[model samples]
Target: MELQKTMQRSLRSEIQKRLKENGYTLSKLSELSGIGTGHLSEMLNSSPSRAITVNQLDAMATAFGHAPGWLYELYPEECLSEGKISRPRLVPYLVRCAEIGRKDCIKAVVSNLLENPKNISILFSVAEQLFQSGKQKESVFFYELVIDNEKDSYSDQFVMSQYRLFRAVQGTNTEENWKAVIRFDSYWKRLPENVQLDALLQLANVCFMMYRWKDVEKYADELRNLATIVYENELLRRTSPKANDLLKTERHLVVYYGQGFLLKAAALKKQRLYEEAKQYIQGYADLGWFEILDETGQQEVEKFRVWAKINSYTLDMMLGNYEILPECITFLEDHPGEIFPALVTIMECANKYGFCIDEVLERFSEYTSYTEDDLNGLSASRHFRFRYQKAIYELQRERFNIGINETLRSLALADKMNHYQDFKQCVSLFEEHRHHASNSQIIAYNKIIEGGTQTNESSVTLVSSSFGIL
Candidate 1:
């Protein structure tokens, strides 16, 4: 087959590259591998196909300082996709390929490994190990293998794989999160207590990005209740003082509680329930979670703490406590680009209650690379919201010239992107500020909003995306 010939050529190329890297020649490889000079040359260099066997591959692998199955992974799918290869012989090669970022080889070997349903456990183990190693792309590959294999089953591994896969892909801006969201909502009550806790936390986090504040609050409460149960169970299981290591052992629960507090605060903040949101924030700080966390956890809690405070800053606007808003943004500016979730949260709050945010916008411009076009997927919508709020703040500051310009920019953006509500919102802003604008500019803005004028959509396609009304 043509595929087999291509595989052969790839192997020969790899052998030559490795030989040069290893300072080996044809004679040296033959001497070290105990393969004849003619056969080795043919296998590694010949154009036409010569059969490559496991024994021959093993010999080359031994000589090349690789695992016995390394060479086997270089072959194309035509040679490996069928169940001809034993699972035992294929798993190590596939795992090595996965670890080394050899995605094509992984694809080839998966079919061979997946020929038997019993191999699912081994596959899941590899996926979990890869995930723990922070090789999420490869982990998702193997986790999906398990998902594809399990089909309709609801076994423990299946559920865990589903959870892990969802968590892994949450921020990738794929449509998969919506499916995962639906699944978690339907199955939360039936899940294990710990899984319920994880699912709820994950739902809250994902729904926050989706701008689903009410759902976020609901999931956060469920997450809090589950964390409480786990904490109680941990206490009951241990009597001695050493058992009091709950703080160290149950670190995720600590994060869960912190996250729950912030989400609950945000929801209440959105509803203008500043007093209740403040109560939750004060309750969270009173528990001293800030002291017990590791460096990463400490930083995360502090960021969320600031994030909630920023929301409260807006909620407390009527009470004249909004002055701290600038200080909170300054704190964020000082930290640089460490917690992106905090950035998203800040932008969301700014868009909803943004006032006098010129300083914050300048800070974001100087301190962040988020404005680059490369940020067009997961964080693209957030970036647009950031710009949107900056415009609102301009209007708030009574910078009529800049506000009109921003309104024009926003209107042009909304129309190009087919943002119906945003175009209307921009029109409303223009009407409010029409008294301050020149008649010509106002007419131009109205025409754009009415779809009576042509504007370049590509101009704003990469400018930003995704905003909702305050």
Candidate 2:
């Protein structure tokens, strides 16, 4: 980045030194070099960056007994006297400096080149290198330069610029991400088969983040189609000497289709299409969905597989397949994302069956303890459910006042979140547990329920669950 002007010889000084050494007058030198005397004088008198045109440079270097490209090659960086830098020489240094983790060098190059609008290609290349090295945020400025200034729509750089822009915004769950996908999908369909498949998998993620379930299925089907073609061609390439090429890998298909399966399974479950949902899980298991994640995707495939399995168990539970409960508990314990529904289900089933309610409560506590920190996507219903687990824990342990207080807390949170499902569940827990609850607990619960649950907590009442079900 630091170039010493004092130690470096100026092109004007070099030309004068060569002229004196050769004992050639300006007119004689210009005549021999075939450059006009006026232009030759300007070349020697002007600064290095603007010394001469390429043809005149070649002519002068050759007449001075140096190689044709020798003069320009001698001075590659900025010419401070002329305030002009060489694009060809400066561009590579910027890229290499970034590669070796030299931020100061890149800053220096960018400061000089950013003044010239045409250095956008260098900007884009350096951006791509930064992106590959996991510096996506840092690479954003370079992508913006090409995207904002370059007008060519059909070029690869334009397509990549849009794709990278989509990558940058998709995780924030912003409206800009939706717009990015629209821009990305417009040209994504026309890309090469391999390139299109890569974008297709990412598009599925974008749709998933937006909760566009049907679009997830559509992209999944598209990915399956593209992957099948790649696999079929891979079969063709097997006859060649380079049969073991990494390009033949179709594991991405499994990743995309696995996600698609999960999304479809979830949608079908919502529609009460249990048989169809079960079918999706069967397909997923048939492929050994866990192993298919080896090629990797943006989402954690193993975690996703656990989620899908938990979902399958839910569908089983809804279908009266109570036998799947223990396995479901194991998976819910294993992977804790999307935990609200599972917590509610496990707690209700545990209470109904008189299972190890304390162990279940502990599991609930382990998973739901994260709410105090306000994690991303921590919904109000989930928070309500966490408090519900706390209430049930207290009730099961005979701490009636604390249990009732927890239910009241859940009621307050549910009301604030407008979570009717949690409100109803809280009411039901009150109905089933008021026998052991105290006067203040009963009054508080009744006030929160506000006629949704009317109970006489003054008398001895027995509320029994089937302890033999387990």
Best model per TM-score: 1
Position 167, candidate 2: lDDT: 66
User: What lDDT tens digits, residue by residue, belong to model 1 across residues 1-470?
Assistant: 98997656666677788899999988999999898889877776777645455566668889998875565556542244434544444555556567766777676556656777877887887787777776666677788888779865577778778777776655424244566687656645655775676667667766655556788789878777777767667657676666655443223556676667766776666666768877776545533433345566665566555555555554555345556666665655565543343444455455556544455556566543443344433354444444465567677778888778767866765554444566678778788888988777887786785676443322221111111111
Reference-based TM-score of each model:
0.63, 0.53
After superposition, candidate 2 runs with Cα above 4 Å error = 1-118, 242-244, 248-253, 270-272, 288-308, 320-323, 331-359, 371-470
Candidate 1, residue 242: CA error in Å? 9.0
**Candidate 2 weakest ten by summed lDDT:** 461-470
Instruction: Give the C-alpha miss distance for residue 337 in model 2, angstroms.
Output: 8.9
- Separately for all candidates shown, the number of backbone clashes (residues 3 or more apart, or on different chains) is 0, 0
| Residue 309 Cα positional deviation in candidate 2, in Å, after optimal superposition | 3.7
Query: In candidate 1, which residue pairs get closer than 3 Å at backbone N, Cα or C atoms, i.e. clash?
Result: none
Candidate 1 lands at a TM-score of: 0.63
